[model samples]
Target: MSIQGSALPARPYRAFLFDMDGTLLNSIAAAERVWSTWAERHGLDVAAFLKTIHGARAIDTITRQALPGVDPEKEAQWITEAELDDVDGVVAIPGAVEFLNGLPGDQWALVTSAPKALALRRLQAAGIKPPAVLVTAEDVARGKPDPACYVLGALRLGVPVQDCLIFEDATVGIRAGEAAGADVMVVTSTHLTPMVTAHACIDGYEHIHVQRDSDGLLYLQRLAS
Candidate 1:
């Protein structure tokens, strides 16, 4: 699918960097459930809490929102436990499995704010193995909107920043990708709004401009009309 905005050149994209929770995996339900439970426990409004922390790191969110009256460390642990316990609804995002399975192992990696333990559990719950090169929270000093994660992911894949394409579902992640000198493609897997998607190369999974072939391999192609 040829996306609108700026007509990106048909360059050879050597690496595809992806965000985990809302990008490759459908873990948002579990996330919301976890957040709601924690919010209710702390007498906070669920919807408002989700809105405030939707695209931020758990540590940052805890420090800013869950701290003061609550122990940030303890609240984060509870959320982790809650999310793992409610992994029943977690699964790969539409076309995600096919997309990952078809890609060359060396050409892609996961860049996520999720810590390694949570990332592992979510990937397992989704029935997919972690990609060869994953930049989890443990791997980064800073989180999304800082560009560190995307930069590390691209470096791990041995690809130039300009040759990478990132798929993200959050505004922070989108900005991270762009800041890392990559093109950003946004997928609305979570509670994203039309206005939030306005500056992104947003598209539905069905409109993804790439495909898998018979050899169980993936390749990028422009969507033709």
Candidate 2:
């Protein structure tokens, strides 16, 4: 990652694509509470399981576990219900509310591994409004690590995938954005330790600013440290 506070290039990005959980908001506390409980019930290592869960759909993760006698779909549904009931600690990442509010309503989209209702609940808890375009788990057959969500997000915004900038915080999401041919800005707000990546990274939206040209194209820049 470019940790020296490099400014984003002056490209004519037409839309901003954001991943919800760790990018726009912090829901780790609530998510871990439910997932850890589920992990313990399944006799899995809580910490390791938590690491694998982020940026993946519940069903996808559960299917990968291949827990004996457990139906992946049913287990995923249980996890979803638990998460929906537990948004107590959800809150916006620093400057997320202001940053999102400043964007033109139609110029951005939310693409998340979370289900639609859960996504809305978390956004509400974080004090961020739902975007004009939201591509949730229900909207796609596959989740992160698959570029479909990101591609669909850009399509819904009426922009070419290459003309969009994606904000993501996880490896799976970064891969998805890159595969969709969009520039990605890694958000490390939820990271517990430093990570090495090829894309430009930001800890939060506090120092980032957006500009719109006469033709309505958007540009992102970083305020000098």
**How close is every model to the real structure, measured as TM-score?**
0.84, 0.96
Residue 137 lDDT in candidate 2 = 93
lDDT winner: 2
In candidate 1, which residue pairs clash?
1-223, 102-218
Model 2 lowest lDDT segment of ten? 1-10
User: lDDT of all predictions, in order shown?
Assistant: 0.74, 0.91
True-vs-predicted CA distance for residue 22, candidate 1, Å: 1.6
- How do the residues 44-162 of candidate 1 rate in per-residue lDDT, one tens digit apiece? 77788887665567876777763466777677777777776788789877767866776788878989888778899999998877899988877877778899889888888787777
lDDT string for model 2 (96-181, tens) is 99999999999999999998989999999999999889999999998889999999998898889999999999889999999998
Best of the candidates, TM-score: 2
What global local distance difference test value does model 2 have? Answer: 0.91
